[model samples]
Structure formats: C-alpha cells, structure tokens
Target chain A: MEDVRLLMLPGPVPLPERVLQAMMRQAINHRGPEFGAAYTESVEVLKTCFGTENEVFILSGSGTAGMDAAISNFGKGKKIASLVNGKFGDRLYEIASRNGDATGIASEWGTPVDLAALEEALENGAEMVTMVHNETSAGILNPAKEVGRLARKHDALFVMDGVTSVGGDEVLADEWGVDVAIVGSQKCLAAPAGLAAVAVSDRAWDRIVEDRPYYLDLASYRKSAHKEPMQTPYTPAVPLFLGLHESLMMIKEEGMEARVARHHRMSASVRAAVAAWGLEMFPQLDEHSAYSNTVTAVRMPEGVADADVRGTVKKMGIEIAGGQDHLKGKIFRIGSMGAVSAPEILATLAAVQHALRKAGVAGVGDGVEAAAEVLNP
Target chain B: MEDVRLLMLPGPVPLPERVLQAMMRQAINHRGPEFGAAYTESVEVLKTCFGTENEVFILSGSGTAGMDAAISNFGKGKKIASLVNGKFGDRLYEIASRNGDATGIASEWGTPVDLAALEEALENGAEMVTMVHNETSAGILNPAKEVGRLARKHDALFVMDGVTSVGGDEVLADEWGVDVAIVGSQKCLAAPAGLAAVAVSDRAWDRIVEDRPYYLDLASYRKSAHKEPMQTPYTPAVPLFLGLHESLMMIKEEGMEARVARHHRMSASVRAAVAAWGLEMFPQLDEHSAYSNTVTAVRMPEGVADADVRGTVKKMGIEIAGGQDHLKGKIFRIGSMGAVSAPEILATLAAVQHALRKAGVAGVGDGVEAAAEVLNP
Candidate 1:
C-alpha cells in the first residue's frame, strides 16, 4: 500500500518536509530551560502570527478547547453574547453557555454574522462577545473588525475565534481592536492540529484570575509561562508543540503578507474557475462578500450532486468538502488554506475541471487558465 | 553558545527525533479517511502497548486531559476508592472526587499502597478503584495486580494509571485483571507527550458507556474504532498521531517481551550502580520494590541537597529530578525511559557520580563500569 499524500480538506493543509524535520527533534521536559526557550520563542512567533501586541499563550488542546478557555476564563458569568452562523459559532455558545452566563445571537448557517444583531447583543451590557472570525463550516469570514469595534463601544471583551482566518487573512489583533484572538495551528498557520494560540488583553486576563476550572485555568498558565516551556497545568503533547514551533518559523519565513495575498489569490482563482463552470458561490453573489481567503463554498450546479463532485475530486487525488448543516449536500467547499498558493491552487483547479467534466458537467473550458490569471494576480 | 539539550524530569521524559517526525506530517481534517486509518491503527497499537485484549481509544489533549477522560468517562459516581501514595495517586482522587463519589486510601509518599487497606475499601461496596501503577513523584509502584484482584473479588472496576509505566514496565492490562489502564506517550513510550492511550475491559466499558464526559466518552471512541485508520471525535493532533503510529511500529518491531526486558534491565542497571556508589535508594527500600522500570528515585546524601545534585547534572548536559511534595529537594530521580536507554543511562549515572563527588559526598566513585556490568548481565 502506497502512503497517501494528504490533500487536507479543512486544515492543517499540507506540511513541508522541512517543518516535519524540525518537529522530529526529541521532546524536552516542560520544566527545563530548553523547553522554556522553545516556549518563549514559540509564543513570540505566535504574537507575530496573531499580529497582537498583547502577550501570546498556547492551549495544549484543540481549537474548541481554547474556546472553553477563552469564554470560561474571561466571561466569568458576567453575561456573554455569541454570534452563531455555523458549527463553530454554535461551539462558542455551547462552550460559553456550559461555563457561565452566555447567549447566542442566532443566524442561519452559510451566512455571516449580521453586524446589527451582534450590536444589539453588545448593547445589552454583555461582558464579552464571541464569534468565529472565519466560520470554516460555512466558509464565511465575519467582519471581525466591525465586531471588535462593537465590543469596544460596549466595553465588552472582543473574543474572536480566528481558527481559519488568522494565518490566511489579515488578523491585526491590536490594530483591529480584537481584545482576544484565537488561532489553531491546523488552520491557516499550517501546523498540525492540537495546539491553540490565543492573545488575551489584560482586561480579559483580569476575569480569568478568578475561580475557574483548574485544568483550563489561564491564570496558572500565565504565571508558568517562560519560566518553563509554556508549561500547562497539565502535561501537553510535546511533539505537537515542537511541530507548532517549527511551523511558526516556517510561516514567518513565508512572510505573513505573502501568505495573506496567496490565500486571497487562491480564493479569487477558485471563484473564477467555478464561475467558468457555471457554478455559484454559496455567499450572496457580490453582496456582503467577505468570503474567507482560504476556503470557497459554492452551490452545486443544476443537476450536479454534492457527493458526485466530492467523489470525483477524491478519485483524482484531490479532496473537497460538502455543506455541514442547512446547506449539506447542496454546496462544495474547496480549501485554499495553508500551503495552497499558485502551484497547489492551479493543480487542484485543473483536477476540479477534469473531475467536473468527467461528471458530465459542461462549460469548464480552460478552467486552469481562468484560475491561473486570478491566482497569480 | 552550546545547544543545550533538555533534561526531562521522570514524568515527561524528553522525546526523540523519530517521534517528532511523525508529528510534523501534514495536518489532515478530522473527517478524512487518511486520518481515520491512522487513528484506528493508533488505538490498536495502544491496546498492544497496554498488553490488553480489550479495546483502545485516544484523546486529543495532554495526558492529564486524557486522565479526565479516563475517570470521568468510566467512573459511575458511586463509591470509588483511590490509592493515594504520591502526586499522581492524588490526581486520581481529584478526578474521581469531582466527577463522582470517591474514597481516598492514603499512603505516605515513597511507600507502596497497602493492598489490605484497598481490600477493605473494595469490600465496602465500592463501585470502582483507581491506582497509579507507577508513582513517579515518590518512585513507588503500587501493586496493581494485587489491588486488581481485590477489586475483582468485590466486583468493582480496577483503574490503573500507567502513565510512566506502560512502555517501561510489564503492564498486562488483561493478565493483571485490570479494567481501565490509562497510558501516556511521553514517559516510557519514547514518544512526545500529548497523546494518551486508554484500554477498557468489558467490565469498565459498562461503566464508561453508562456515563462519561461527552468529549471523553469511551462509547463514541468505540463506535469509531472499526472506522478506517482511526477517527477521533475531535480534531486530532495529526502530526503527533502519525509520529505515534511510527513509534508504535518501532515498538512492535522490537517485540513487547524484548521491550519490557529492556526496561527491566535498565532499571536493574541504574539501581545496582546507585547502590555501588553508597547512595541510599530512598527511605528503607521495599523488599518487594514499587520502583518503576522507567525511573529510579534516590535519596540525596545526608547533607548534599537533591536540588544541588540536579543543578550539577544540568551543567553536565544530563537532566535529573528532585522529589515532589514533602520529599522535595530530599531525593533525586534518574530515568531509564526508552530513547535514552543503556548508553544514556550509563552516561547519566557517571554524571551523577561526578555531581555527587563535587558536592563533597565522598562515597561516590565511577559508576560506568558498575552500570556496564549490570547492563551486560
């Protein structure tokens, strides 16, 4: 059996062998100087990744686990508001609701957060407002800056789950007024999943110092940071942290601007190729267009089944996703997150064109060329 | 500046490069077949690591995070008995106390669990009992099998923390009549810390299936067991899993018997060398020792502090550990965990002898020859 080279559907995309080599180093004791240096440098790199001036810390769990830490830590039962537009948005509510006082401003799946609804929630004296900046489930990029401003106006902590957007899009945590921003290594950062990096403002930290789950306590982590290599209250997966450290260095080398531009170009190219194939994006056509630079969600063409499209891509050594909730079986989600630049995007678009033609879908002539122009631009 | 290598304390022995390579692989979506295949195989290897014939499952967080899954998942909230000897044993009580009703059978640190006391607890209609098979903090190994038999005699579940013992000791989950065996990758496994493997017997499964933390539910893991590669409930740390898969294969190739023999031999070598140097092996060592095959804790000389001993080892590029809790700065711990096997042990022992001599402990002499003789024997 041949080892399968992965086309990661959502994230952490494909990793370069160079980063894998760096991750292969031996695990250091978390309480050792070697680990301390690694942890400190890694946090510094995360600060770069988050584009935040506030201190950066990592949660030794999944992206959602960070959601628990962020909301449970800062909200402290002082009413919290969440934006719900996708599975991720629902997660914010579920985690916050379980921890303390929190409410979700509901929105339909596949739609971005209506800024108005969030504004209304914040106006009601919400202690914190949480939302997924890029809801991967629906492939919609919420206006995080707008949300952050609203949080500021209402004196609420602006907590954004930048799991999908941070590395691939513009995540100026400080400049954009995002009091707390979270990013998962598996997403745009392109590290393997397992580590979650979040930058919390001092205001947010003030609330975390109070009574909280001992295991997920951020206050304890704050004190332990730098003294040891990002020592968690619990034993972390050291290998993943090593991988994250290497991946962060790789991201810096690639240049954040370059990464952001590449994702935008890939999304634009994907749009062009889909347009040529007579398919439509799931987001409103040109209206309120804040599509994630990484993943493009598109509705199936008339007579085209979502399974058929996904199966075709799979057969051709390409992987695409399908709708998660209301749009399940109705749309195709193609990811351009992490390591998806000119060559990857073009190759995938070419494969998509071939797969669609094989599926009896027409009007995809010169799909590669159409995508190439936008991808390179 | 010299590139400093980390000296991992006994609990999270540093990882080797081979393990890190596996974690550096591309991050795949949790909902992908490629990952599914990897996840399923990891669980299978996990069963073998625990020497179990039952089932193996994985959690995506730290070893402690997985500990939460272990107790919270299988514990029935009924009367539970926890053998408390050291920090880790206390952790079992903490988990049991929070999620359900628990009775802690206290033992002084550095002393083994009194099976007679545990038997009394079990006989009192205790629904479950938890034990740390190897206590890293005090270098005590509770007789799990003896306690396991007691639990069986009273029809109570037997849960063992194999965190530092699994790959380092002869952990026969089934043969020992153990119901729940919790293992971590870092300690003796030579893999990085983060991934934890748990084996559940039919008896424990009944409890786990009845009520468990939703995220840590053993039933959900069981449902996904037969699903290709392996499918975890949440976004798994892909690179680490991949690395762990590779590490397990390496362990399998070595064969379980040979691996256990290696750990036992290493333990014997370290003990013989420590005794040869006239160093005390903790307060009045047990005739039937509770010492872990992975790590050996020794009492520092009457006047020479453990902290002083550890500092010298750090300077020599070898890492040693100090005692925890009440024993802090009184005892020094040296590990024989995998990756840093015979060669590393011999080197560390030599360094320890040097550190002791420097501390004005004149009983110290060359331990390399002594350790080497034990290794050959």
Candidate 2:
C-alpha cells in the first residue's frame, strides 16, 4: 500500500475532503446561473475574510496574476514605492518595476521593512506603495497597517499581498486602508491553487490606467461582475472555482474568528516545539514586525543540513519547506495554515524530531511533547 | 436525485471520468518532482498534439491568457494584422490592438476570413498576423494554412488560436508554419477549464519583446521549463495540471488520428442531422474555409423561438449552447469535441428533435435516426 503523505508546505496545504469532492464533479456551463451562484458565494465569502466592502475580483491565474493586476491597473508609468523584505515582497517589487516606475525599498530577508525609508519614498513623489503583508518565504508578517497608514498620509494607493495572511491572520483591509488586497486560493483557503482573488477599493478604481494588460485587466472584471449573473471577464477555472466555493463555505461554517484562532494556535504550537528543540527562529522581528501565523521559519542548527531535516521528513511522508533562494540550507519552514489541526501538527513535529535524532543531532528535546502542551491546552 | 447533465457546449464540454478523478486528490508541492513530472508529461503530450518540435509552455489561466501571451510577447509595438470572423477572432483582434499597433482584417460573422484584405495588410507591412484556427463562436474553421502561407510570404509572424482544434482535429503547427499556436484545456482536451498551452516556434522566440507583461510572459515560462523537471515560472494550478496531464494521456492512448476521426465523425453526425431536419448550417464556408470538426452551428428555424428549442432541451437535463453576442437567438451550437461518443451525441440530438416538434415546427425529420446512420455506419 502507498503511504499517505502529509503536506506541510507554506501554501498548497492539505485540502479538505469537501473541497476535493467539489472538484470531482463534471464541468458546468460557466455562463450559466449555477456557476454565477457559486461565483457570487465565493466572492461574498472572500469579502468577509478580507474584511472589506470593496469589489473583489477573482483571476484565473495564480497569486502573481493578482499582483500583476494590482500594479498594472493603477501603477503603470507612475512612481511607485515597493517594499521588499523577502521573496514574495521582492516579487511585488519586480512586478511593480515591470508595470510602473518603481523604487525598491530593500531590506534583509526575514527582517522588518524599513518604514522610514518607505515614508521617505512616498514623500519623494511615489504615487503608489506596494508591500506583502506576510512574506511567506521568510515567515515574517510585515506591518501592513503602518505601511497603509504611510501611503494614505501621502495620498498614494496601497497594494498589499495578503496571499498567505488574509484568511489565517488578522487582515482588516478596509481598516488598514489597503487599496488593493490580493489572496491566493491555495494559501489560507485550503483550496487548490490556480485562482487569485483581489479586492479593489473605489479609490483605487479611479486611478486605473487606460492601457492595461488585457488578460489581467481589472476594469473588465468590474464590468463583467456587474452583469445579472456575476461573471469574470474571461473563462475562469471552473473546477477551481467550485473547490474555492467549498473551502470558503467551510470557512464560513467555522467562522472567521474561530478559523484565525485555530491558525494562530497551530503556529504557536510549532514555534513552541522549535524552541523546545533548541532551535532559533529565522526572522528578526521588530516592534512593527511579527512572526507569521501562517508559517514559521527556524534556523538550522550549526551542524545540521536542510536535507537532513526537510529531506528526511519528506522520506517519512511529511513535506515541509526549506528556505528559498540564498537562504537555502540555512532555514526550514513549517506551515500551519488552512484546516491543519493538532494531530497534523504533532505528527509533523514528531517526524522532525525523529529526523533530527537520526541526523546525529545531540540535545534534541521532546519537541512533540512541547507542541502537544500548547495544542492541548 | 439530481439529473445527470449532458453538456454539449462549444467548449467546457463534459470532462472524462479519469480527468475529473485526477483533480480529486490533495494538493502537492508545486516545485516538487511530482508536479514537475506532471508538467513535463503534459507539455510532452501537448507537443505531440500540436505536432510541433518547438517549445510549448502551459499558462495557469484560460485560453485568453495564451492569446494575450502570443500577441504581447512578440507583437508589442509592431504592426499586427488581426483576422476577425467571429467572437473569438474578434478577441484576438482586441488583444492585438491592446498590445500592438493592430489592424483588423474584417469579415462577417460565420463567414470566411477576408483573405484578400489580409494579403493587402501583410503587403502593407504588417509585422505579425493573428488568426483563429477554429472559431468556436461561429463553429467555423478558418484557413490557418493559407493564412500562415500568406504571413510567411510577407515575412510576418503567424499566431493561431487552436483552442478547440489541436486535440480533437488535425493541427500540424510546424508544418503549417504557425509561429505560435495556443490551446485551451477545456476545449479539445476535455479537461476542466483554466489552463492554456502555447507552442512557440524559434522564429517567434527570436522576435520576443524584452518588456512583456509580467504574468503572461512566455520567456519566463521557457526559462523555467528548461529546468531539470520542468516548471512554470510562477505557482501553477497544480490540480488543473494533473487533470490536463491525464486528458493528454487519454489523447495519446486513443492516437491522434483516431481522435480526429472520432471528432470529425461526431460533427458530421450533427451536420447530417441538421440537414435531415431541414436546418441551415450557420457559417458560409468558401473555398478557403471549412466546417469545424469540433462544433457545429445551425441557424434557428424561422418560426421557432430559441427558448422553445434550446431552453426546452436544457430542461430535459441536457445543456447545449445558444449563440453569443448578436447571434443569441439566431443560432444554436452543438459541441462534439473531446471524449464525447455516439451515445451522448444521439441523446442530445433526440432531445433537440423532441424540443423542435413540441415547439410546433412542422416537417421535423428524424434527426436522431439520421445522426445514428452517420455514427454507426
């Protein structure tokens, strides 16, 4: 018999049975009323999760498509300030540079964004500001409220990548003054990948460019959404939309407050386990920055290698993430987002402990027990 | 119990059970070998279906995304001649105009493209030429080979939308000198909607623009595909890729010749049924144009209301398509693309015949018997 693997990656977490079953059905007419009802329900749930009353559009591409739409729609040929602290943040900067005249406010990965630098850029005529609320690569939650505040002070549009944070963390988009907020289906929603939803404020709509990318055009989405049956401008991934609707319904059933609390508790359990194993956290959080509730990053021990930990765990049928890019082999990340509970977390922790011991690491404490303490309590 | 639906739309046809089952699994790490294997397999089969030795990249959006990529990548800032004979043909023109300086070579809907006007545009120094191999909107197969020949003579790039043709019909991209050929997963492949694949020739690659749209950039896809296991540059719709891989495998198992023959026979069955019922085919096919083998469009009878025909059939748990845009009540389309066989086609014809008789249309012949004659003999 094949072993049942557990997925613990930052995004694309294990999907719920409901979501899976939803995709198992046959194709439906995308322009029909049935698909429209599903689309409407998913959009309404997304608005609740995003904590916004603005118009939210779902793009058929991944999270990057949403980021591209966010930037290209309103930031084209305009001076934009992009804050980069990690891989996803750097992605926003890259997309911004491609669409607009962008200035990157770079900081070390797994660290807080330089707020003063962001403010200075805005003051120096940056008309738009873009940042990632949670940098999944570094497992650091950037200060979205502060960045939004600074952008608002300068009367600049603020675009935030909430791909990994919106559902699992506290994201009051309207309260934070986020002009455009983006989320991926596979992240905190525990749905399949390939769909990205973006919430656009009315203020941001007024600043949209006339010449925008055709596939990712936001204005076209708006026009289509206003039809009798809500529809995307182009053909959406119908199965993904069905799966997303199921996942969103699950979220609604559990309630956002309960879901966020579960996510927070799960991440806390993993952090506790890491500390118990004498591991250091990867991110250096400041007053404004904090550890991400969706995923946690830990520094590898002095003598231990990433393959020894993450690779070994993979052999044991549990998938964790190693650091990306330059941080490879230096840090490992544990994702606690999207329908993960105490059982999955404890099993992952036990696997990691076993892998560490097998790697000849001394002084490896009872990490599973430590995690259970937090999870059970 | 809910009645099982028989979907016969121009695209988004009923998915095969194997394809639907493939998407019912849990999410996997997209950057891992599992996803890479799936991506590589899908791409390989796509090359076989496209009959090309050139590189084919899969984008995580719909067919429009591929169209956008084809134009925006090489046609940007160039003079592009877009051939428009139907809705999807007009879409190519729309995308071309958005990304490049484009002139639409116009022809009436459901009519052959104006080859003379297209030749004139090419001689007038059009840098790129875009055409739809199968215009699904009007169920007309445009003359891609002739268009490609003209474009080649004028030294213009040829971008063809083979969305509903490649898997179900004959599409030799390289033989036809198609610079870039695009296909949708939901169409001829009979997979779920949301994914698009583009085959790019060496000539098209050499002329690709440096500053392209961030999400739909084909160059990045090519770069990522060159990696060990092959990958899309961004996070792909993992489940959709799995479904696509399975559908492509089914195509391979059936053999391209057999699949094309089946599609042709099914469309012929429909056309024979239409002729027996005394209905007119929608498109005015000229010497260079031909009837599509993936879908058939028939003009509505003069006395019958569209609701009395299509709506009644739909109520009987069968979903065929009415016309789009101005063709709304003027024509109805029956899709025979993908894995649909004699049983489904006969059922749909029977339903339509029943509806036509009930709508008080006189001299309604035995469409089912006529279709059966074509299907069995």
lDDT of 2 by residue, B30-73 (tens): 77777888888888889988989998999999999999999999
* Candidate 1: tens digits of C-alpha lDDT, residues A26-51: 66666655566767878877887788
Supply the global lDDT for candidate 1.
0.76
Clashes of each: 19, 0
DockQ of the candidate models in sequence: 0.51, 0.74
Off by over 4 Å in 2: A1-4, B1-4
Residue A126 displacement (Å), model 1: 5.7
RMSD of candidate 1 to true structure, Å: 3.4
**Weakest 10 consecutive residues, lDDT, candidate 1 chain A?**
A1-10
Candidate 2 docking category? medium
Residue A278 of model 1, lDDT score: 77
List the per-model TM-score of the A chain: 0.94, 0.98
Which digits, one per residue and each the tens of the lDDT, describe model 1 over residues B1-377? 12435554675666666665566555566666667776766666677779899878876777776677777777746788999888898988987886678989997877867677788887777888898888888777778778778888899888889988887788888988998888887777777777788888888766663534434556777787656645766677777677777778778788778888888888888888888888877733455455777778898788887756888887878777888778888888887776667777877888888888888998675677788998886
* Native contacts conserved, per model: 0.71, 0.94
lDDT of 2 by residue, A1-377 (tens): 12439989898889999999998889887877888899999999999889999988899999999999999999999999999999999999999999889999999999899999998999899999999999989999999999989999999999999999988898999999999999999999998999999999999998999989899999999999988788888889999999999999999999999999999999999999998888899999999999999999999988898999988898889989999999999999999999999989988999999998899988888989998989888
